[model samples]
Target: MTCSEKMGSFYSGITCQDIPPHVMKKARLTLFDFLCVLRLGAKYTVINPIIKRYLVSLEHPEKYTVLGLKMKSSLEHAVLGMSVVSHGVELDDGHLSSATHPAVAVIPAALAMAEKCHSNLRDLLVSIVVGYDCMIRFAKAINPKHLSLGFHSTSTCGTLGAACAAGWLLGLDSEQLSHALGIAALQSAGLQEMLHENASIKPFQVGKSSSAGIIAAELAALGSKSPSKVFEGQYGWFNAMSNNDYRETDLWDRLGKHWMIMDTYVKLYPSCRYAHAAIDSALELYDEGYRMSNVKNVKLYLFQQGINEVGVFKVPSQYEDALFSVAYSIAIAFQYGKVRIEEIASNLQNTRILEFADNIDIISDKQMTDSFPREAGSRIIFEDDNGNIVVRENKRARADFDTPLTDEEYLLKAAQILENVVHRKYIDVLWEKVVLSDQKMDVKEIIELMNEMGA
Candidate 1:
């Protein structure tokens, strides 16, 4: 069978029994991380407004609870709302190979479909796992070139992942699932131009991709038919968008044996993943008592890929710019002792921060540049007023799956977000159930608990 056929067959054949205990544990952690990030986005000015606007436009409200918001929206609207919130802070889980935010795309779609279909807890979790797996696998299949070719992977690959998850939730077999993917592929579109212009449309890509995936799955359920070979056919996704030689076998090489959800990196900082290593290096220096005032010059060495990704902002004047700006992130870390979600909102143009950012120089270090994608590393050199120099290097940040945050640390992060949206007592109670529940609880129950807390 062709790659697309094999993938379709694999998705159709896989069952909960196929998932190992360790993989399921990782999936649960991912779900927790997703909820935490979504809550954090609830407090973001940009995210709340978009969610409010979308919620206000819902034609017929459903029973699904929009996270953090006390309102109910249509399934489509709910998916859109949740997606915006998930991506609002840009802190969602990301697949390094595809460079797509899988949770942002998959979780929203899964939640919306679960509410509408009245799926149980097991169903909800499986759908999320399936969605993340499909999205990341497709993204890995179309690697660096798809992202480099000016298509936003989060939107493009996310759409396909959303479709797969939605299809699974709706119980579509291989044939119908294939059609859903094809339909979603046609609707999948997000330009990297938003990055070039530094616009707010970047986060919207997640919502759009997720909503489109739901639409595709619904169409397929209604007996729609589309091309099955959406990935590796002669004029398929890879060839059309990537403009590179296509390999169909890469799509299903180790399908069930390797779970992509485990490969995702959870963000410690709320900024871009490309900037994490630089932030790590800066934070290390600070923890070692490196003061900002004493530093005369700050130099950063990163991989060529890092330079291409986070090195865009020469002089960022705004919060969004700062998120994408390695120079700005490094400077903020040096000046403020750390970078937080709040730091992105605080005026970035503060003279001290700007002055430090201006003194920041970023260059591609050949040694680090050669090992990129395999490893994200950075080196920071600080020169003191007395001409003393301190250098710190970090190969990767702590939030990666390889070096995951402790349970307490993860819950603390979650609590910080939950405290902002709901009451502190609710955070403690809900966290108790979430962390220690023997049997999985329904997602709706979780939402209901939050609603009660708000009430």
Candidate 2:
């Protein structure tokens, strides 16, 4: 069978009962994290251009709620806003295996489609699982090469994934769902060139992808036809997007059997997942008495993926560059004891952080390749005046499935992200009303609650 057929059948087969409780919890946090980032990102200047370009001049239909803005928006515009915000902060949930920001691409699209269909919490969770599974699995089928080929996996794979969720919500049959996937695949657009140039297009691509999913589904339902063999055709996404040396792996290997959200990694720090392992090691060292005071130079023996993405920028000059800069992320960790959006934004001219970041080295090593995606493993070396004060190697990030964040931690994180933007009472209400429970949710009501609770 064709890849599209396989995935369409898979999406058609999954029921709310097919998903486990733990996966449900993971899906809830995935949704919650998207909301948190949306709350925090609403204030960013980066978000202004998008809002003005879309919401200011164009009229909104007042069908859905944007996280912070009081203006009611259509489902497409709402998803667009959510996608922009979720990816804007760099705090979105990631699928390690696919190297794609899963939640930013999937959750927003799911929310928009769910809102449109008035889908319950159970089906919403199930749709998210299908969407995430489709995206991450397709990404895995054409990864490091997909990165190497200059395509951002989040946008490319997310298009198809979002289509699955949207198609499911819109009640599209397998054939229509296949067409939706095809049309969504046709809309796949993202380039890593922005990473090198410090452009905002990366997040914009995610926003576009999120909206495109529903559009594809709507068009498909209206009898739009596309290449059914969009995935494994002679010029399929994998080979067309990646290097010619591509083999289409089982993108739908376990589909309904194992959910993808269960394997997602939550960002403990608001930076690239690539820097998480090294940052964790640095923090652990500080905890073990290797404080940031006497550090001279730091070395990170990183997986190929990490080295490829964040290795070049020793010092970032613009807003986007700093977000992707390995040195900038690690510097903020050691110097400020955390990686905050303000630190990266306001400290662009901080010489001390720049010099320290310049002292850091990210070397690509093959030993960590096997553990890559599944684990963002790193080996770190710290040099101080005392000479080689610490050496940390062979460690993966803590947010892996084994050491997942607790409910208390997620609530605290939610409170922290919302502390400055939304009131504490609303944050608590949101946690109790939406995230903590597994009941049918009126997304519009939650949005109203947040709007009422905004500081």
lDDT by residue (104-194, candidate 2, tens digit) is 8888778778777777777777788888888888888887678778888898888888888888888888888888888888889888777
Alpha carbon lDDT at 101, candidate 2: 87
lDDT of 1 at 420: 48
lDDT of each candidate versus the true structure: 0.76, 0.76
Per-residue lDDT over 1-455 for candidate 1, one digit per residue giving the tens place of the 0 to 100 score? 55445655677667778878777767767777787677767776365675676678756656666775657787776787788777878788887767788998998898889878877666777788888888887777776778677778899888888988888889988877878888888887888777656555677888889989998899989998777666666787878768755354556667788888888888877777878988988877777776677776778899877877678875676666666778878777876776777776685658777777777888889988667666788898878777888788888766786777777877777765555466667666766655556535666776676557652
Model 1 regions more than 4 Å off: 45-47, 61-63, 246-249, 416-423, 452-455
> What TM-score should be assigned to candidate 2?
0.93
